[model samples]
Target: GARHGINMNGKLQRLQEQEERIFSSSCENLVEQIIEKKKKKKRKTIETDE
Candidate 1:
């Protein structure tokens, strides 16, 4: 029983690390998309002014 508990705890730790990695990558992708959209908006405004 003790060994099983230890194994489960280790598994939980690994799962948490995996979750963190996925979340970080997703956030990075979202930030990149937002920046790109902002760039496009700025470009559009500049073109409109001209």
Candidate 2:
């Protein structure tokens, strides 16, 4: 029973780590998208100014 408990804990820890990695990567992607949108907006403004 103790061994089973240890195994379960290990599995849970691995799952948490995987989730964190996925979350961080998704956050980075979101930031990149926002930056791209901002760049596009700036380009549009510049073109309008000229």
lDDT of 1 by residue, 1-50 (tens): 99999999999999999999999999999999999999999999999999
Candidate 1, position 27, lDDT: 100
Model 2 spans with C-alpha error above 4 angstroms = none
lDDT string for model 2 (1-50, tens) is 99999999999999999999999999999999999999999999999999
Report, for every candidate in turn, its global Cα lDDT versus the true structure. 1.00, 1.00
* Best of the candidates, TM-score: 2
- Candidate 1 colliding pairs, count: 0
